[model samples]
Target chain A: MHPLAAVRGVPRRTWLRWRFAYLVLLPTLILFTYLRVFPTAWAFVMSFFEWGLVKPAERFVGFDNYTTLLSDKNFTTALLNTTIFAFATTIFSVILAIALAAVLARVVRGRTGGLLELLYFAPVLVPMVPVTLGWREIFNYNHGVLNAFLGIFGITRVPWLSDPNMALVAVIILSVWKQVGYNMIILIVGMRAIPRVYEEAAAVDGASAWQRFRHVTMPLLAPVTLFVIVITTIASYNVFTQVYVLASDVQGAPGRLVPVIVYDLFQNGFRFFKMGYASAEAVYLFLIILVLTLIQFRFLRGSRA
Target chain B: MNLRRRGMSRVGYWILVAVLALGGIAMIFPIFWLFSVSFRPASEINTVPPNLLPVHWTLNNFTVVFQRAPMLSYLWNSFVFATISTIFIVLTSSTAGYIFAKFKFPGNNAIFMLVLATAIVPFEIYMVPLFLQMNALHLVNNPIGLFLPFLVLSYGIFFMRQNTMTSVPDEILDAARIDGMSETGVMIRMVPRLLAPAVSALAILAFIQAWTAFIWPLLILNDPKYFPMELGLSQFANTGSSNFGVTSAAAVIALLPSIIAFLLLRRRIVEGITITGLQG
Candidate 1:
């Protein structure tokens, strides 16, 4: 009965179903376009101009912002810091998670295992701001618990947050502690999903426990391990809330000492009102993550083959 | 597998337990310190050797936290933002997911792929333009701006689509169609109940994300009255007069809702993360 339906020689029911599908998808598609697609395109365009927040001084800058970023010391620090943070966090968290999952797989049939899993996962549930705050107190130089504990060994208080090098290490430590549990759970699930027959066959072939795990369990877990690494790297590269909360005070690390990419973008975009430069930085961050993700896909496909 | 276990001595098993128990303690000690310090009296907070438990417990820090800032308002704002955004995310994701999974239409796979592609683009990449857009629309500093970017999550769409395909059967939908139920009627009546588990999982994930959001709220909101708990707590800690006890109390209060939610919906949350591969 519909005009298009009759013209296209389609059944009314089929046309109606298509109509219903489009009708259902329309609102979400429109929203996604407006909020996500449009803004992403706009950011690219804005990156090419000298965009500002306060003044109406927007003009085409012809890649000057990108060139300036080459000489910018702060941006360089942030890039280096983010790279270190990402690599350290990913490697440490992934290895520790695999170890924890391996142990738990052997002992996880009962209530005690569940309780331990929950205990490790508890930090993952608590909000980052508060947990970072708790870590800040522990990392405090004087009269803090960590310092007090170290004093027992007659090791003088280490300024965990104040020194630039130590501050990065402290951030990495916090990140690993918060993230290991989540990866552990994922790896545990991955380990469980491995059919037991392979391990059984290996054992029957006179493979020792270590030998079976090295060959059988490890190979199967490659995909999940790669997944954890990729996601952790991406997440770590976007680390902001912890750095912002932890380094903005006198008691905590100085922001300049613990510079990260998102913090750089936030500072440039919001604090200094340098929208154009910030967009360029955002594009750079996007490219790094994009490349990382593409590498992951390639690696995943390789492993599957 | 049993043979492998049989080779291990009893001593090894207990050693493993002891090591894991120690690791668990390390994992939970910071959280324990948070609550312990929060209950300490202000005088005891500055002691040279910090006691793991408060020497004398008092509720004065909580009272101080409430008095210093608009703590109640911050909690309310967070609740409203997280709840409303979660409802919209669940609704949009479920409907979009349902269509993508069940319906045959042109460009279905392409469109779904497009939506999923956006998940890989971090918010930091586009937030500059988004801020300008919000500013142009006069939404900055408004509560609506706090959650505008989050109302439609790409991950939620992918998650819901995967769930709908796995759980919702084609026969049931065809039967409903034959029963003369309008597509909208079928969706309204049956899809939600059928997809209840996935819906709850997505809802809790979205809620926790919105509730814990900080940087966007910090960027969009300047008014103290509009601050979410994250922003509020940050500001509280930044104030020069803030002390250890009071600040810890504020942090504890900000963390309470998530702790409560995690405890009540542990299995669902865990299941959701495992399925979706969502990191906190």
Candidate 2:
């Protein structure tokens, strides 16, 4: 104590070291508090009040908004559509990605792997607006590429975006087109990481490649598969661009996913000045996502156990 | 044994190639068409027999887009905003990533978990209030308005943190401490080289996020003059009644920078995607 008391003044070096991390973290904390946490809290509070976009007054409406949303047929249909979109895309994409990645992992050598990956990943870089425009042209009934190609096989032209019966499928195709590459790359990496020793051991024991893969690789890749399923499902549920572009008219008028519902709310809330209803809708969509994510977490936990 | 294995492998290779070749064409044909239609005269875009390839390529469409829409202005706006936003993101996330990776600070685990938790919340949900906050701060319609919110990415932080935690060994930090390097000095000098992969990945992700940021900017910026490329492209699409050619051309212009950027940094982009997806 006597020796340390003699050196009363701490060095500038120690002073700077003490505050370095906080200096880095302080701005981030403030930013997140303002942008992320505040918005979420405001959205929640706003859900309980009837407010106008332009007006300052917010009347406490309590549970009426929730009741109204529950009775709204459009809301129910959007919820259903969101569920369908999420499950369908997740299943198809997971299966297709695993199959494609498994195949590519085997044969692609050196430079070809990079080229194939480049081609597959091109869509990720392509912005949503242009991608939607290209899809519109591709899905065009008369002069569209898909119809033109199908004509060679004598199949009748399909009204992809126009027909409500097929509109969901069209959106699904775009979602798959945009996302499958991403999922595939992930799976390919996962497949590559499976030690070659397992395959060689299986081969030595007279196991076929498919059997070896099913027993050894697939089981090992289960965590990756689970991760993809949950993330893709959530992403598909929240899909906005394709729906916003394709169903330009009557977007809120039943039979679209939840994000479309959110978009509709955006228009109504901001554009038409119905802020209360929009906040209510936002909360509803939040609950749906919350429940789905909770289910996914539980599923992952159960699988792990 | 050798012949059978060789034959099987060859057959597998060809089939994979055939399918992927087909799939690749199907994927890239849209991009090809976007370019083809962009250069063709307006009349040729959706003609009776739609042209697969423009007979006479011209800069006329680009010229029209530049004249009709503030395409160049919008592009400039996007470039400035994205560049600034990306720089901040890289700087802040890398530093925070370093802190979380190296130091055993108080509440670190809780903070990390909170950052990770925020990842599950859709970014779109924060738009309205963010707009309100920006308005209160008088940041609306400013480039800083566009740049600031995107600067702090939870995903980037989490990514950098994970990368650092795995690769930046404590022994290295100990050695630096022994050499009397301050923590900031050690981080600044050492982390960047070690964080090449994470930084590259985060940069691409940050660039893409800022570039495609539509709804947030649409809410915050009221002026058409301040619109990013995404909003500009949407404007072109929305005014579909009068100016299909210009709209399509504007779309073409919007496509250029992203595709070009991706081409230039394709490997980094792919690496970034694979890393994020693997961590999924």
Candidate 3:
């Protein structure tokens, strides 16, 4: 017998040592193959061809979809819109979260943590549809509370959702409002994990609140900050539900945002039975997201390193 | 503890509380508005002058919501899908988590790295391919379409591994094995009790993810019969009906399960996020 195989019961036979491990991993592998790998492979294959829902035969069109996407007007616009939405949401949500987290860390005592967390957490649990519908009501030009609030200061109705120019901004605000609480919770935990010793040390050196925050708190929160930024950005890029609900269609009057364009493509591809075009559009979106995600991961990795 | 900063700290804490309270209200105001609107009469919605409070409060909207569409059916669909997916996630992840934590196996690190790598890939790319795969298998518009793909959660496995490795001591596991417990027996009998909290936390996350899942279900489930509440809500909202009250009511119904679940499981949810955030 091999020296390694001399174990009495617990197998020194390395492979036999973990039948349970294989058993455990079996379902996960099967599920991933069916759900993730199979689809991902199929999509990759489909990307290389011109095919749709109804086409009798798929024409092999290598790189055509990729090249065409680069030139498509709607694709460009959607790209821009997606960028704007993601950038705006990420900046505002992160700032708001950091601000709220700082305050929550400093001011709230006792049950304050629980209370603030609960309140912020409410929006997360509330279904997106209701939240979007509520925003629609609030952004209703004539009777909307937002306009009503602005009217109090003798300001004119801002056409919150009506004007395409302001529509994107309105959508961004809704996204931030829905998400800020989540970021706050995460940020607060980050802030809390920074020990009291740092604050005490800073105070001993006569460092003011702003000084301590800038030097002590912010630096220690590097990981959480990166997490918040990456998640928010990725999520913003995938900002479909809010946009679909708020803006309704892709052609936002004279112009459309990237996701709206994607949705339009989807509508054309699937709804209108233009499968070939929709696949092209999906592939286009895939490439864009892929590039942006790569950039984000690279930047984050580079910064961290 | 410093006497000099005591008063300042107290004042600062109160100020922060007030600000956070206001912010929290701002965050939840839309939800409150949704609730109030749902209770109002049909005529009250889109009124000449909006009523913050309903003129004539009634449950008629709720009644009509059930009557107007297959609201109950949609609710059941969402509940079933969320439940099945969550259960599968918890069970598979826990087992995988146990093996990764307790057993020293070759390629463990490599396997974990592979699983974690998928986390960064935006799921949008996989969406269409997944649909096509389902179509190929004739699973389109099927409930299994929602549950099957979602079952293999890399994050769940990672989470379970992280939790078990940290929480389950090797001694207890070794003792279980010495006591004639099979490896599977050790996992089933011993590991679960130790990993209950992590399991619940994962369950909450899985539930929310599955419940709020929009795009996947939207793509796969074209049949109205399998329409989850979120999609159903959108369909109702877009029907161009003047009954905003009922629409709002249906929205509320759709949202209630998650809201209630979150409220019930807020502690677990908060702990899960905080723990994951800290560890990461």
Best by lDDT: 1
Among all windows of 10 consecutive residues in model 3 chain B, the one with the lowest summed lDDT is: B1-10
DockQ ranking of the models: 1, 3, 2
Poorest lDDT segment (10 consecutive residues) of candidate 3 chain A? A249-258
Which of candidates 1 and 3 is the stronger one according to TM-score?
Answer: 1
Best-fitting candidate, scored by DockQ:
1
In order, the Cα lDDT scores of the candidates are 0.86, 0.74, 0.75
DockQ for all models, in order? 0.70, 0.48, 0.55
TM-score of each: 0.96, 0.89, 0.90
Candidate 3 CAPRI level: medium
Candidate 2, residues A22-81, lDDT tens digits: the string is 787888778776767787777777777777755634688897777887787766667677
- Model 2: what is its DockQ? 0.48
Cα lDDT tens digits, model 3, B51-155, are 778989999999987777898898898889888888988988888778777777767777778777665555665676666667778898888876777786777
After aligning candidate 1 to the native by TM-score, how far in Å is the CA of B14 from where it should be?
0.7
Best by TM-score: 1
TM-score of 1: 0.96
